[model samples]
Target: MELKEITDHPSYPDAYWAAGDEVFQLMDPLDAKRTLRLRANLNHNLLLHRRLFLADTSILVSPSMFALLHDEELGPGYRQLFRDGSIVTAMRSAANNFSEVAALIIEKRNFVAEMEEDQIWASARLLDSLSPEIVRTDTRDEMLKIGHDYVLRAEYWAALGIPENVALAMTESVRRKREERNLDTVRQSEFWEYARDDLLTPGEAGTAQQIRAYMSIASLGTMAKGIGIPPIYPAAYGPNVDRIYGTHTPWEHRADRRMKLLEPFDQKDPRRLDEERNIHEIAALLTADQVSKIRDKVEHRKLLKGAQQAIQESGNSAAEILERALEEFRGYLEVGAGEFLVDWEGGGRRSLLWETKTGQLMRQFSSGAVGTAAMIPGVGPALGTALTLFGWRRAAKLEKWREGFREVTQEAINDPTIIPELRTDEVIELSLFGEIPYSFMALGGDAEEQD
Candidate 1:
């Protein structure tokens, strides 16, 4: 292939050339102006080095534009809390980034009306705003959002283990060849993709969105090239994007990470065989339905058997194996939760749901693999809600609660002593029920199942 084929022409940093100029122009960090060459360069940096080089100090960040505006400190840095509650810390580059990010706040306050779609326009209006100004004197931080977050995202990808250059190249390749024109793509791609997508939607789809995640993801590059977007709709039928997105959820993370085609940062391949095996072995235990959800899309399963065998030979119980695998897999979900969040009730439930999914995942691949994670734990709010729980007990409790709750319903009649009129909820909806069981009463207790 020509250099231009692999590395987008002229943009030394970009990995591939794009199909359309209009979309590429829109990608400019300035949002208002860009050249085909600049777009390609930005694309190259994002894909190769995963770096976003700002030649123009005019870039600024609008505070009102961010989700964590209230939580973020406008220092010389860009940071975020991780999916697991860890902090994603980044220092301000000499490229005159964050200060400009700060100044962009004011300028973009009226940014909402600028979006193409009504939903997107409304969203831009809602974001935190930066008081932006024209660059005066050698102002490094005059505030203009860079046209690229590939660099930041590339660092994140490498830190997570994909090759830095590979990420850069892949990003450029897709960018040059295609144009991501929707919110869903951003959520799954890098930070910039997410930011750009987020900029267009004022009100998020909550947990239930309207995008078909798995199929959309599959279409991004090679995986979905001819596959066409899956009828991700539940049972391949639904108008809600979230249902389709939901269908994509399980395989999406694995597939995204599995497509870890990036060259290792050090030139040597950083293929995580052990990690790959863990996923397949884990998948083996999932049900056929679950396996079907991911089997075709995530190609790394075949590559994981050796590592899975090695891990299996270690005598670690299925749960132990899954835990280790999840530690490595966590970033793909890439859902942000704040650090120092002591309550698992929210994030905790989500985590448990993830684990339970693994367990089901184990069973989904093959019945033989089902028992593998059995020794692990169950899922749901009961087991996940706790701060101190782990091991078989946590799983056991989750299973018991799930089993019980599945069959539970509101009692037919209110108790005589539990007067409906006198009760007002000082706490949970449990108050609405008036008389509550002592066990489900406390958050600590509700977080787990009683023996």
Candidate 2:
């Protein structure tokens, strides 16, 4: 039950624990071995999920994802990805989401039945030891925004026919509590609890339930807590209505604008429901890949332009500029074709393959007789050939990428190391180079129509 006992187990090596001050000092062979193993494990896991999450900045783990990562079967595998590094694993706030998770565990008492009390304690200890980052939002300006969002949400609910008195009371309670506690900001943990306890009489829970239902209908699930459906929603859908709209629109006009944007649709209309689903699927695909693709294109263009200008200004021949451009393109290809191998603890190694849209273009260019023609004296012909072959072999490569993505997606589902967040629908969208098929847009479209 003790921390030392839990960490010292054969399955849990010393490498798993945070290194102490002794690690900074000169170490014997045993200490050296421990540090080396720790470094290797951290590096291996970093490479595993970096491609999937594009977590060059930070990986923000939701409460659900965090708990799932700590589950008995999946814990060890997912923990590998959370190793101490420059790219941190962070929760939104310690006083917010993390506290909610603790509260949930206490409330259920058997939420994770297999997780013994001591194990739970040890898990908390491990989290402390790892020192995963927390996003701070306690500044004065942030608190003002937070307060505004609370009132905005309340006003939205009132617009949807919740009693004006009820809505005012809810917002007023929050304002009163902030003053009473001498707090600038209300953490998510405090806000939700306050809403439930103070929204109505002590025994009345109906108002809180109603508010929750309305929030769900609007695709707003604890916006202050963590990542939700809003991030994946298109800009026109008013995803930033809670925070950004308040800054531009005055309080009086805000409700009308939000109501128009978030107008309720017929839940029973199959066509309407289908359209909503399609929009979400398309949005998720765009969120995951299209933006990245656009950025890559812009960057590629800049690189080519820069290369040409440098060569031309230096009094280089046209061929030299072309050669420089080609070198830049080749470097882009190398970086885009991200192929890495994962060594499994069970013994065998598996490969994770990723290719940018340009990789396919490169393949098509290299395949045709035009590629031979591209060997002319000037670089103009080669550039023309490359551009011409951009859409060539599209169908074949699309199919190949789709199949490969599906296989890796399956591997992700079965393997805990790779988070199973990628969807087949998104893969199909990516395969089409960000195009959503008409069938995908239709109600109850046949599976065969996907091709």
TM-score of each: 0.18, 0.32
Give per-residue CA lDDT, model 1, range 348-415, as digits (tens). 32233223352242222111111111101222222111110011212223445435422221111121
The C-alpha lDDT values of all candidates are: 0.22, 0.28
RMSD from true fold, candidate 2: 20.3
For candidate 2, what is the total of clashing residue pairs? 0
Q: Which candidate number has the best lDDT?
A: 2
Task: Give lDDT tens digits, candidate 2, residues 361-440.
Answer: 21211111110001111221211111101111121124454354344334323431111121111100001011111111
Off by over 4 Å in 2: 1-67, 84-87, 91-121, 131-140, 146-157, 198-451
Provide the lowest-lDDT 10-residue window in model 1: 427-436
Candidate 1, which segments miss by more than 4 Å at Cα?
Answer: 1-242, 245-317, 324-394, 397-399, 402-451
Q: For all the candidates, what are their Cα RMSDs to the real structure?
A: 24.0, 20.3
